[model samples]
Target: MWLSGAMATPIEDYALISDLHTGALVSRSGSVDWLCLPRFDSPSVFGALLGTEEHGRWLLAPDQPGARVLRRNYLESTFILQTRWRTDSGEVLVTDFMPVKDRRASVVRRVEGLSGTVLMRQELEVRFNYGTTVPWMRREAHNGKERLLCIAGPSAMVLTGGNIPHGSDHRHTGQFPVRAGETVDLELTWYPSHRETPEEVDIDEGLARTVAYWQDWAGLCVDRKRYRQPVRRSLLVLRALTHEDTGGIVAAPTMSLPEEFGGSRNWDYRYCWLRDAALTLEAMMTHGYDDEAAHWRNWLLRAVAGDPDDLQIMYAVDGGRELPERILPQFPGYAGSLPVRLGNGAVDQYQADVVGTVMVALSRMRDRGVDEDSFSWPLQRALLGFLERHLEDPDHGIWEVRGDPQFFTHSRVMMWAAFDRAARAARQDGMDGPVELWEALRDGLRTEILDRGFDAGRNTFVQCYGTVEADASLLQLPQVGFLDYDDPRMLGTVAFLERELLNGQGLLLRYRSGTGVDGLTPGENPFLACSFWLAEQYARTGRLAEAIRLMDQLVGYANEVGLLSEEYDTVDGRMAGNYPQAFSHLALVRAADAIHSAEAEQRLRSTQPAEPMESSP
Candidate 1:
């Protein structure tokens, strides 16, 4: 669980469990190696995933020398995981989950002996600030029981039960044996050190309630029977990555899990990017999640409350805006990928597409019957004003390229989408706005894109104004209702993308990073979200068979538990970038829905009665 040897666990080997506010990564061997306390962006308390066990971790697995993990999976429609391990003597089960809809932050692990007597070991090493500070440990009594209190700076965690391991040599260790039909429970709760250590929770009741909570939430997902399992799991992952209290969805729980191993492409993804969050909202809203849309809308309103010109690309889970990027040189990164980063520098970059993404999501919510309040619509108007104010400014683009700004065609198209949505809102919802101006801007931008964004000779839209390179994001052209998927122009773009961006196996690159477009080293895997987008493009364009094939292929990339990272290494056959990326899961949902919609349309057309009477009439 704590790495097979000196090597870090494969990124795909980690399954995610979350309380909604934050999440933890549990490896197959039953070690919680990556967990940020309090919030997804908080300093990690257990970061052994990126470093050695000395960087801190919580291990609860068979102590036997040759115990092997037989299987692991989530309980039906829930984040509660059951990992079964087999040993020469017998078998044991470990159930791990974080209680949802709870009062405090807690993770509960229950180990039960299923068949025979098994020796189990529990290890707890608490580190603060990305494993740099060893917490001061003390014993405290609460609710007629003892709990281990660990305090380092402002963060304090209480470990209860499990006959908790005793600290020896700065690490807590305990070995206990259990026979068939026996169970043991261990819990860790985090809170501010200033607050009184919270009272212990009822593990049995909490476990039952947590299971019920996740099951009920999952039950809300719109069933897509074609790819039901992956769709449901992806929806669950989206929910898991969202902050329960704030409604802010983080891109991923772990940060600095490199896009390219041993490369500086590693970036912190714990914060909420407006673009990713908006897309997530759109995905959920399309699949029977109106409440989440409302919650995220409120979060958006709070996050962008100030002057529109000052709006940032991302924010903390609680709507905090001061996210300054810094490198943590202390803990060597995952697989020795150095420069573990905190925060994201892209927050300050001008990404022209974000407003459009926000508007599109808001528009979807409106279409789904979520009425806009005074603040929400007014906020959009202000955002539109801001967009108009900087209509011609070049941006860093959606990939958050560190290179010089460029008039990215994708960003320009999304800017067009923003105005188009505004016009629709005024016409359809009867909202008071400058519809004439919005329509004019939308039409003008469409003409401009056609003129400057497309390469006539290649018959493809370039990545930016001047570059001839095709970007995978061009697959989204039809998605925003900007162009017909099968139109000659879009078809040309798709053809060019297939020729240039798609790997032989059919995965997509955001762009050839080697082109110096990103101003970073070239080595990176195909972005999984772009592949999902391609699947959507294939679906929308009536390439149903190809769409299904691509969809199935992309779904297969999910880990055993149906979790997808940001990218996949085709050559090395591994996951890349941040794990359990919200972007990837949300895109999966959209792609699945696209396939379902296209298939349904095909079936409807096939079943239609022949129209012979029209000739006579």
Candidate 2:
């Protein structure tokens, strides 16, 4: 039977490897339990990580008991991972993750000797559709050597390695040993079932090409103001999460890794969020990776070329729109969380902020001089008109929830941003639109937001109209330049955040439980992105010492491999929620850049007039 003792909830023990099409998170314990193949949103052919290994897997590690892990880390700036383990006999290392190439199908594993002889185990279990379907498998010859092949529906994989295992349960099993002065190379090739097996000869050359591809991609980053290490790491991560061929960025690698561990707050983040994509593109562009930005912009245009009203806030990485939400009852879930989920149901919800976010991205594109397609301007006009029609209505906010729509204050502010930014784009870029009407609407929205969303008595903006709760999202006012950072109102919100949301570990939770924003069990670890936003806000408002103190504390929360999850359980000092969240990493870059830029701005202003500040605080 497959063992469960080696699984880690902290994401520390697991090293992630992906081809940017899909990814697999492999714990050091010889198990390949979590992988959604072909595409990030595709059904898992191996999901034993969330359930039992019986659910599915592609394991190839030492089968010995009592073996312990030594260390793990990415190979330099690339997504390739090296995991070392030590046992009584000696030590051995397993290098895992998919090989990166342009549109070809392959996953290469290279195991090199380090010490004395070490016995290892290899077990392969293939279950498609969340472990419900066993694919047809057979042995074949490629270049005179026998290779195992599996094909189910349209998905297919070819694994090449040493010491072919013998099995009768449709699962491959074997035991082998590795000693000093030897190397073993394995490759898992994925191609369409109808297509013939791909050409595969040397694994070492593929490994080198994979490493060089990522290094060259990451070397384009031009950010040098500050936080060089973390910035580069986040950039590497963002690059890792992106699909190389389509240039579509998945929100995260895995899905159903619940927010509340055993709770039902799990979601399929495999699809792309327009809001996330826009911010991600801005981050990439700022770091001097315009190629990704252009690709993403192209993806956006193709994904939303239909009616403006039909514009989904998200889409499949390949621009597909039909993400049907469904439950997989075959597997229990992570820690018995129940009803394992696939596909996102939020595609039908209307989020006003998505429009504003898109507008902001288009504006950023125009400002950066990134050339757009001929239809780009026309598409923006349709979206803005749709925004004009629905600007006054209350719908679901940025946080996709099932509860009744309420007048979320932040949503209105973004609507104003939509009009204001749209007007700016038209006036400044010579793009023709209803600039005059949009400006009037923009001023009117500002008036409405100031009158309704702000609490004059409390000197802060409420989470929504008539609500006194302070949301960590309110901290975004200064970052968006919706309000001045040093404004007394923003300062009051900052103080309120500290008073209400600050946990003992100096991280900020999203909000208090009493507010019914999200319709679920009202408990979660402090969101890492929100806390980082607090740091940036602190830096921007001239609370530099407080910013540094909080920033340092949060950075310490990263796993040993310099990776972070969506949330952090401060009480246990463990990561919670989704593993390697794009939201967390994206905001991290922005905040780090924000802090560094703020510090530079502060140093510059120490000699000039206080009003000499150039950009948003």
Candidate 3:
């Protein structure tokens, strides 16, 4: 009953459901188009997000044509999704979720009829290894319950519930009728093929437990009066991206969603970037999640345990080091973007800003009363030694540009910040370290950046030394205390960015393409995070009204479920790139915090008595 040739759903139409170990993207049409099992970086079992339905997908919707989606939203403070649909014959509500803290990975879908009799259809295609392998499926009975067991090379899945689909030509299909007040439940569990089929889950217990888990976690967030809903949801999203066992936070779930539709700018984002993870930690700690900071710090120690010289920009969710880039010829690509990639090659590049980000985050943890431990402080000292060794090395920079390396201004500023934080920690926290050396290095780097990285005549900082082009990363200079937000130089740089990088719709681009800087095709939508950074800048620099306007506009881009992708195509008004991106969500949290702080300060000032006109001079 499902259409094999149906067009892929728009990126924004997908809502994320995660158990903190892995995630699935369920479309508005009730299709599970993307899901990686066992881990966030694992091969997907449902790969229709990148290719056609023939690849893989799970669909559960009304069999009747013209069944309209009335509304869909995540349950309060949780990833549990509820979608209501209405048809000529009847109405039905579908609830989808993944159980938290469960021993096994599974997805639960329950359909309840609300009105007259209605017919519903379920279709599933199981393809392992990113749609390259078809699984062996068989119908069997487990504990007197009918179930469908699917086994591939090493991965296996079992479908058990009130209704099971029949198989034909390696595809499963089923149709069932339900009347008002009737409910049908279906649960899918993934496990190793060598093991026995997983038992059917208790649908009622799982739902209740999942809801409670999310609500409890969300309740821990400190209350905010402004942008409360968005900030809370964004924090929940960051938590969802974090791996429960390893404490690794991924950049995004789905990969190879083109930054530019039908373009080749796509790359995998399932791995954990040190910079991204540190930033995520900072965002969490800013809102009273110090536990996450300590957890991720342990992950950091394990990841970079060996020689600090061997530090990489990113690693696998479990701290894997060997991530070789490869093209999947099987996937025709999302929207015809070519050479769908797996395993980021940038993992091997030297991104100078990574260690700096980690250090800044750890410094924040220390400030928040997370005392430095024996291993943690020693780790910081080791990282400082590594920076001392590579102090002058040109890096690929924060964007991981594929072109020739350069002394990127933003990276240099972050490097300065690393040493600045280290020296301050040594002097203030009484932590043992080479404080004098760190202070000297920090000051010298500051001098060099101001001399060469800045364009004196233009009064704006360049993307890298020996260039006039502005970069969005420069917007973060004030974030790390490299400069004051309202400094004339920073204001000039913001002006330059507004003129050069603002797209037609007033959103900020990372930088102008075609400058031979990134060494790729000249195309991509405005990166969502950069605009958020701009919002933070505006909020901090006395431009409260402008900041509020930009903040509202940026928040509006979140989908109906308050989820954001990596980029937004203003021309088409659709989200592009990886869905539910951690970078975007974390930046949103930071921006909202900045706006709230600014608003609070403004209120405080309004209540204060005037300065008595300086007593008439």
Q: What CA RMSD would you report for each candidate?
A: 2.0, 3.9, 1.6
Candidate number that wins on TM-score, 1 or 3: 3
* Residue-wise C-alpha lDDT for candidate 3, range 113-132, written one tens digit per residue: 99997899999998999999
Clash pairs, model 2 backbone: none
Taking all chains together, each candidate's TM-score versus the true structure is 0.97, 0.94, 0.98
Worst 10 residues of 1 by lDDT: 1-10
**For model 2, where is the 10-residue window of minimal lDDT?**
1-10
* lDDT tens readout by residue for model 1, 504-563: 778998898878788987888899999999999899888999999999999999988989
- Cα lDDT for residue 280, candidate 2: 82
TM-score of 2: 0.94
lDDT of each: 0.89, 0.79, 0.92
Q: Model 3 has how many clashing residue pairs?
A: 0
